[model samples]
Target: MSLYLEAATILESPQTTSLKAIIYNPSKPFKSPQPKLYALIVETLKFQDILKEVVENSGILKLERKLTPLLSILLTHDLLLTKSGIATSSGPLKDALLRHKARLNAEFTRARLRRGHADIKSLIGAVNAEHSRESEDGVTKTATGLTSFNPRWVRVNALQTTLEDSLSSPTFHAFQEVGSVSDMFFFDVVRKTYYRKAEILPNILAIHPSHDITSSELYKSGKIILQSASSCLPAIMLDPPKGSMVVDGCAAPGNKTTHLAALVGSSGKIFAVERDRRRADILEMMITKAGAEGIVTTLKATDFTTIMEGHPAWQASYILLDPSCSGSGILQRVDWDISKLNLPSSDTTSSHPSKKKRKRDETLPNGSASQPEERETKQLEEEIQDDDTSRERLQSLSDFQVAIILHAFLFPNARRITYSTCSVHAEENEHVVARVLNSEIAKERGWRVQSRDENPLSTWHRRGLVGELSDLKSSLEEQRRVADGCIRVHRTDSLGGGFFVTCFTRQVDDKGQFGGGIGNLDIVPAQEDKSRSQVLGDTTEVENQEWNGLSDEGPNEAVSAVDIADGDPRSGKRQKRKPGKAQQGRTEKTNRQFQKGRKGWS
Candidate 1:
């Protein structure tokens, strides 16, 4: 706790503030931006972690699930407000925190420092000295891992050509085959690059960021795309049939749309829906660039739920629902002023700035605090739009997500549907699945979890959590089966951040019938069936509530009243409960009551 406070204080200092500006804002240039910029970003990321720790320990800021990316952004501003700084002066972060009344209790911060916690004075002194040096000479000791840590991944357009063919071509002479792992052979385009990930996909290549291939013939020809492996999982898991129709419910910046197009082939059709007109334009461009315009139809500025009965998309066999989430899975993003950097140059160059020079000092880091000076009040309102990480906001997002999936469930021919999110929250993942399964529509239409044995990515290893499936109206065995059906990838797995994917399928005899499976807690063993019935029958004298698992008893006393029923002479010899109409009806009635009692579990 003290460490977090100290780090926050250091990050909020005016010296750190000036250093951040000089490093991030090119207009406020300083000599030799490499070392100082790297140090500044590293320190900012450290402070981001510190802030996360503070939020987790504060115990007051009850985040719905995990901290939303927008909340993280706001928290950094609050960290600045810990002491007097520009971020504290009525800016958007401060304003947002104040508006929501979400600021941390001061007792958890500066008060800890005043107490006898382990001293952070030396750490503060060191950071201050480094900042002072950077301000003076615009240089500081560089941190490691910046170069090796950040890598660019490229996915080959399977519809165009194979990875091996692309690598063998004269245009890709600079690339070499990566080592054999995951039975996936990757190509390293940048020689001497440090390898971490073995494979993103069979066609995707993870390479060093130094390579400049954006202008290459292959990229221009739309034979390769820059997409992370994690983002590619939904399309892969959906495994749409060759001639089937599919819907990308929240399609925008259509990376997955093009990938789905390739999978479905030219004979198949796709309905790409996007609510935002501007993003829809970009999606259209990407679809065109990928040469999928023939098969991919764009539903520009349209909400997916509005596609009602008799609509062309209604007949689709597969639907991919990648709704708007908190985007907590994104590890990092690099943003820069492209117009300023790529402007025409003087002297003897071919128009635009030299590729090397343009790329220089363009390493703007994300996944941490933003450039404080750049993201003032107006920008915060524009960037975040609202408090996306708040409990109310999460509930809203979850409700919207549930509505999208439920609407998709109404599709008559929708045989397979994949619901995916970049969020790690149960409210959006397992809970959503449970809520949908418990819905009258899902039960009536025979929608249930597509078992792992039936899914393509069943061998991916990491599965959904069982603990989060407690609210689902299914037996423990069925719950475990459903958990195994879902897939989860952590942010640190190097597969392009955290992600969750689960496929829902409909069958003639889908076990999703309401009041059939109320979880395992209500089940009775065959050996105890007769005794249990006798106990229930004899309990006319004793209240039903008296038959709990156990109650306080002395050493010489019996553990439970249940033992008396087992030893009763009236207990039937037949151990099995007869599967007759009378017994089944009674069992169903009991289950209904049990389910009603457990309604508050979620």
Candidate 2:
């Protein structure tokens, strides 16, 4: 098929299939290169409004019966916007498009003039300005444009390279340095030129959102990571000591896991736990890419709540929990904006009255009958308003969030834990924090909110909303202190997205009485105690064995409990396990049974 036809097919795809997935699908590959196809689609969508006006005014769709609305838009984009005309070779479609080239060009110029532009250049600038404004305001469906106030945050991976070395690298040679993050917000149509070193977070740099840093050598080499400032707060707040063991409770797509690795250095060990198989694969890949494979161990298909007394992760001194939430605070995806474009229609009533009616009643590609134009537009408007933060959903998420944190509190060796979410709702943030603090485990283990004065993010202006914590059974003064300890980033804060994070700390004595004891140890049955002892024995044996890196089965493969060991905690030394066929067979069986139980939790 022609490039125009292929582009049209992709544009007409149902909302269920993302534009990227359809364009990049290997099974149904396009004749044209994927990158070229993607660029054409994005550029066309950006200029679609003006192109739609031009096409309708020129009456090309009315005259050309063969051209679909999507086809005409794609062909018209190439014919007018691009320097070179249509990319396809001589054909009936090409011949037909070229036949109306003069009229199309005239209509485009007239459309530009109608929009109050003196020339094409001014019209382009105006459209770009509107695009940037809309992206920052996030008031329209196409809100996350190429340029916006939300600066692209890049963190120099200390595991691979230092911030000073990364800045001196050739990747940033063309860029000019600015004094503040606010400077990165100003959009320049020609090019993105300025970058600001973040004062609030170490090794973080904010750059113009328009700059495609992923294409840089530093990013590809894993020296630089694209992570939001809000997401980085949890690790910074936890500030795990070097050589300390840490656990990331929900460590998939591991931005915080790798950050923790960077802080702990190679001497420290990090257990990155992820219950989902697919997401564990992603976490492993990220850990490998960030050059933290040595410092970080991925716990694949392992639920955070399932880490009992026998698990190696139970010995972690620090834990970071970023649990599932409504995701109400996340920035609208740029691809989502493009996918929701309102493509111009080819079925003009003037040309074919019956055909227009038939098109209205036609079943869409996803098998849903098309609605009236008015209803469709209204539905699109409604979709722009996020409904995921409904009361029922928030309460469910709050309960889950409290449960995850309560589990973290059960860690016998845990000294600190940070709970965070990409949610703007109070129920998921302060409410969950309050609920966890009020739990019996939290009070018994002496897990209290780390004071604002002691937190590394003390200088950050935004703190938790005290009003949200009114339900807590604590003094107003104590409630205010807890609220002040928490950090909250607003969606419009220019930190990239809405986020909430708070640290909890408790002092541990030598005997581990106040901070180290498990909350419900007496409630467990005798049979369960035997199983726990076996699990601990198998884990200890694995730790004493050779310290080889990820298994030969590839990073995505689940790392069995018997395959990993933290070594003797007191001596901090590796001792080879005594060889015995019967003992090895029993250990293997136990590991398999333990894995089965963990999978069942998922």
Candidate 3:
């Protein structure tokens, strides 16, 4: 009956009938202490034999900082009280548990427990706070209740099939039958439709179409993979500076690796490295399934950072770094029932019912977007919260991104490097981009940007991750403009995941320091009010005069000024329009640096 007695029982049989009973009990609120914390404590106690053996034999007297991660669990679960608990060779399991001690101290936990209880009824009530999926039949355009959305796509490898040929396949027809999806416009002439982000479709799931594109059939193989369209951009950068060899860091799941392999074709070699053995196995299987043999070589190389030290071919022409990122970009799943709370009674054995559907509460839509008053009210009250937790996650994820970008350069002669993440966070996108460009080594290595027109279907842009990307004065900005061409892509505007990608090239001919002296954040000072003789305070349009007599380094080979009238293509004067996706994305991240911070989709 006592808590300690029950704890002992749990330790005796980690997989006892009683433990399962508590875990699956819907009516029995999980109110006594934190379950996650308690569960970990019981697990450690259950494995005491092995732990004791190691600890005793190792001659370790007291546990301290090194054992903190393991010790914290016990302290939190109430399994071991400091002064009253068993004494080991050292003292009680207390000191080194500093970080979690304050958190798990019984007094603190019980104080916090005044209002939080997790019984079957609470669980059901939370999920069914919205409409019951069992009751709702029509499709909802908003993904408000969804937790995960898995969008479908196709990968077209030239060696296997051209985009045009693949679409005509009988298999392609079968796939269409499985789902009702419109053809993606951003697709290449041969294959792929950047469908997910563009959200060209109303929802993530595909309704069975009247006709279909079957991917599995005779004369057909898995070479054409079902991949996320957002994952395809890294290889697309292969459109230029075709490399002789490439490296895919963290290439497990093989989709991106295979894309690179396909881009390089048979003549080029690709090294796909995965450190985890189990994941490496999966990668190998995917590689085989996709028929990417001879093109990609899978490696279980742990020290990829130093892989180049041994083999001479370690120096690659192109390196693609798709490090692991949070799956935050995924559309939510369908089990979410955001309306209609369904509380369960105390004795209802959780049986097979909760698995089928947990009931829940949901938020109602604010109003019509077309109505200004309604939209304004909704904007103020229904605005999504970008809390500190989400921001921290963005920052942590960006750190990994920055690390990978910096590491990509370790390979010698990697002329082109493309960095991308499915994250819309500026911390992950522009911040990382900014930090890498500012690095002394990146600058010294002669790496420059390859900016291009991004697709118009991403939210990050509307939020301002693009336009304010880099002031034209920064070397990275100039270099990127030279490479990728500075086109912004928006998920709302295009059919792909909210993704950020840009290419870079090493100075090929060692040009004379990129046009002598370009200032930081350069905006050719708008023309001095030539006509009115008024002092121009930023709004004057300078003839994109610098564009006319561009050096060989410029976009074109020709150097002729066009005769101009207002808004004419021949006119040197640049017409102003709202900032494209790129500009919008930039403004979203940091606006005090720019003017339009208030126009955001708040």
lDDT of 1: 0.53
lDDT of 2 at 169: 83
Tens-place lDDT digits, model 3, residues 164-205: 565566555433332223342112221323232323211122
Worst 10 residues of 1 by lDDT: 548-557
Superposition error at 312 for model 1 (Å) = 1.8
**Candidate with the larger lDDT of 2 and 3:** 2
For candidate 2, write residues 1-602 as lDDT tens digits: 36777777777766564455555554565777765676678778778877776677677777787777777888888889778878978887777778999988888877666555565655554454333322421222222222225666778899989988887788776677776555554332213455553556898877765454554667765688777778889999999999999999888767788899999998999988776675666566667667777777777666666677566777898999887776666665444455666566665443211222222112211122224554433232322243344686566566666767876877777889999987777888899888888878777778899999998899998898798899888999999999999998765566767789999998566785556354445433214423232322223232223121221111211131111223321233322222234323433454465676453322
Off by over 4 Å in 1: 1-150, 179-200, 333-388, 508-602
User: Rank order by lDDT, top first?
Assistant: 2, 1, 3
lDDT per prediction?
0.53, 0.66, 0.41
User: What TM-score does candidate 1 reach?
Assistant: 0.53
Model 1: per-residue Cα lDDT over 1-602, one tens digit each: 22223333334444522333334343533333334333433445433333433344433234332333334333443354335322334544345344433334442353224223233332332232222211211122212111113245577787787777777765576555555221121221115232334332567766544454555666656687767667778888899989789999888767788889989998998988765665665566667667777677777655566564435776798999888766544443332211221111112222112234212112222122225554333222322221236665556556766777877877777778899887666677888888888887677677888999888787787788787899999899989999999988754344654578899988743554323232222222213223221322322122212111111111111111111112321232212212234323432453344334332111
Q: In model 2, where is the ten-residue run with the lowest total lDDT?
A: 358-367
